[model samples]
Target: MKLLNLQRRMARAVMTPLTHSERMRTVAPDGRSMRAVASQIIKPNDRLTSFERLEIYNRQYWFRVLSAFAEDFPGVRAVLGGRRFDAMAKAYLIDCPSQSFTLRNLGSRLVSWLQKHPSRAGERQNLAVDMARLEWADIEAFDGLREPSLKPEDLAGVNPAKLRLRSQPYISLLALRYPVDDLLLEVRKDSDDLDVASNAFNERHKRKRVGAVAKLNPSAIFLAVHRLDEDVYFRRLDREEFAILSALQAGKPLSAAIESALRGSLIAVADRAAHVEKWFHTWAALGWFCRLEKSPKNEKAASRQ
Candidate 1:
């Protein structure tokens, strides 16, 4: 019984989420400092000291997480430059240390944090925040659950008035003041010669255009962030489409959501009638929606059968 209890305690210490205070401790309750602990675990052929061995894990941990952040916030990275970007990255990690087992979950809170504390490391904080959101959505769309598409036939003849439709988990709509999307795309296609000044074009100040203005009226965007055939895409949406999807996301019924969308513009009427059909068709073609909810009539029929 004593041996079992000791084994369980050690397991908990290894697997349980460590507190910041706990992490700061060089040694654990097992009388093993990180250096000694790491050295003890090292294979026989390994020649490094416990400190050096542990340093490898520490270095790789920071590297992998930072790289993921950089990939997720390319536009922000462009504006901030390498030196400032790394500083902001370090600050972010320190403030909200990784809580999940996977590194991908590390940046989930970063955008909201940036919005609250924008002046980090001399970066244009709000712009970086927006870019971070865009990038985060990109990461999520790539990694989130993929549902099977609903066939057009499945939705056909179904009363939109009665059905409650849900947007696929992967699609996200974002409204932004700046053209971070276009700028990021341009930078990705172009060479390392992308100048920070060009990226932050100043039309009023007489600077030549590198890409269209990052800022837009209303300072928001309607975007569809989703994956099709294993490739993630960020497609911009018209106001009507955005409204329709937003309502659906809020769990409004299909008829009500369509009606709300129509109030925004007359296109809402046609779009409402055609939107589900078109979207489902494309969704089916792309394999975005994974499961379909059967109507009451179908459920009854299946029950009787």
Candidate 2:
């Protein structure tokens, strides 16, 4: 075989999702004995056979990928417990192998994957999905690209009807079916406490610690996940406020976004007009919007002034 073809074959073998013992079988389900294949391609060392040497690479690859995946979704792991989380992670990796160079992208499809394969999560599927979404959003907010923010003063002269505001690139607007932010925060707190306590305990008296999975009642939750400086925060939004932000994120102009917000039953018709100024003030103060999106005509008109 050509050198490049040989390299690709080795990569495929190493990345193929299988246990070491399964790969060592004489006649595997794939019809080719992995041991036979390994012997044909690999040069065995003094201490190990071709299959044993190949298994070393396979184990290391999986261990590193799974470790990074677990680190990225600790909340999901907490919700599912160790055994189930391990199974789910293995299944997810088989289906959605790492396409990106960075380990950070490992759990990118986790939410949707959990939704489709709810059986993998057993009874805690919804909770798992919600936690995955929140955790993934936190990851995005922490490292996602940043856009220049518009100051509160930037909107002073702009007409609300023609003004289109762009959301900050790092900001994420999520409408979840459960109050998962609270659950995740609590789980993380408990995990941190356990870590501290474990360090101080004598080895003979140390016990295995598991996170308490709480029963959370389902409720519609609107959240804004964004970063301020180096810290990420989860801000709960009222229904009306969420509608407005969702609309703006979808490229609606300020007037239309406000109309969308007011159409929701959360805000009374009389109160919407009165609240518009206050909402914009709060959103601007939070640095939610990056800039006003101006049309070519508006740009030309402003240039002539």
Candidate 3:
């Protein structure tokens, strides 16, 4: 019973934060206390208490996470400026405390949070939100699972009727009105600034402006956010292409997606067949489709005939 109690005490001691009194009791088996063990960490000339030694770890923990955040959202930092960025970072850290052991998960809620309370506050709010999402996609693409390309031989024996397809882990589709991709590229070059002056696109006046006009167009854009060969790529797709890809992402068969792609317009009728064929080849080459589905029991089930 005494040994058991000692073991429990030892466990609690290790788990809890060490106070000065507790630190004195945390001795080595050879009779040296933790204070002795941590002599190097605690300075001799200073007036700092034992708590101060441990406070260094606390400060460092927040610093590293903040630094990682700054690295992940450099464009955000540039847009917010230094003082506002620091304030935002502190507020963000408080509202959404770190849940993961690594700093990679730090910015997971950032884009969503920014959407709720935008930093720009005016016309640039949507643009800022879009940029945040783009930055998040870049970070997520770097962290997600990377699967080996499926062998061509694997598809050779497959029957199309009984098949179901899955999207790659790193692929995400975003529909936004903001020109986020262009803004991110501009920010990276450290030349362009976010313009929030105009509220609508005037095509007649826009065409007259040189070197990319600062007008907000109200047209909806379908974006494919994916990583290929370790680099993030964002491409804007036309309405039909977007519909087809969205259908495919929903696990609809290739033929069905193609039909959906061509459902509305007479103009798309002639291009449907060729578009479907090319899309299949494109998805295959880009490794965007997966054959294995993760079941409710957490087991992977291959598409079966």
Give the Cα lDDT of each candidate: 0.63, 0.78, 0.61
Name the better of 1 and 3 by TM-score: 1
TM-score of each candidate structure, all chains considered together: 0.67, 0.88, 0.65
Writing each residue's lDDT as its tens digit, candidate 2 over 1-305 gives 99999898777777766654434344434676778778889999999999989888877888889899998887788778767899899899988999998888999999999999999998878878888999999999998877778886666666666667788888888998777787677666665677566634422121122222335466788999998876899999888888888998897877888887777476666777767778778877777788654677435434554
Better of 2 and 3 by lDDT: 2
Count of clashing residue pairs in every prediction: 15, 0, 0
Model 3 pairs whose backbones collide: none
| Ranking of predictions according to TM-score | 2, 1, 3
RMSD of each: 7.3, 3.9, 10.8
Off by over 4 Å in 1: 1-60, 121-123, 191-218, 266-291, 295-305
lDDT of 3 by residue, 1-305 (tens): 37787555433333333233324244534454555434533454467655356445545555666788888886565445555666677667657767898778888898778777765324445655666677888777766776665545555545453345666778777776766676566555443222542313322222233113226575677887888888888878667777777877887765566667778855556776686677667777888776544443113122343
Encode model 1's per-residue lDDT on 1-305: one tens digit a residue: 37787555434334322234323236654565655445455443457565554455555566667788777666676666666788788778767777888878888898788877767834356566667878888888887776666665655555566556666788777877666676666556543434544533432222112213433333666677788777888778767777767887787766788678768585645556676567545645765443447767434433553
Root-mean-square deviation of candidate 1: 7.3
Candidate 2 ranges beyond 4 A from true positions: 20-29, 199-214, 293-305
Q: What is the Cα-based lDDT of residue 218 in candidate 3?
A: 50
| Candidate 1 local lDDT, residue 5 | 72
- The worst-scoring run of ten residues by lDDT in candidate 2 lies at 202-211
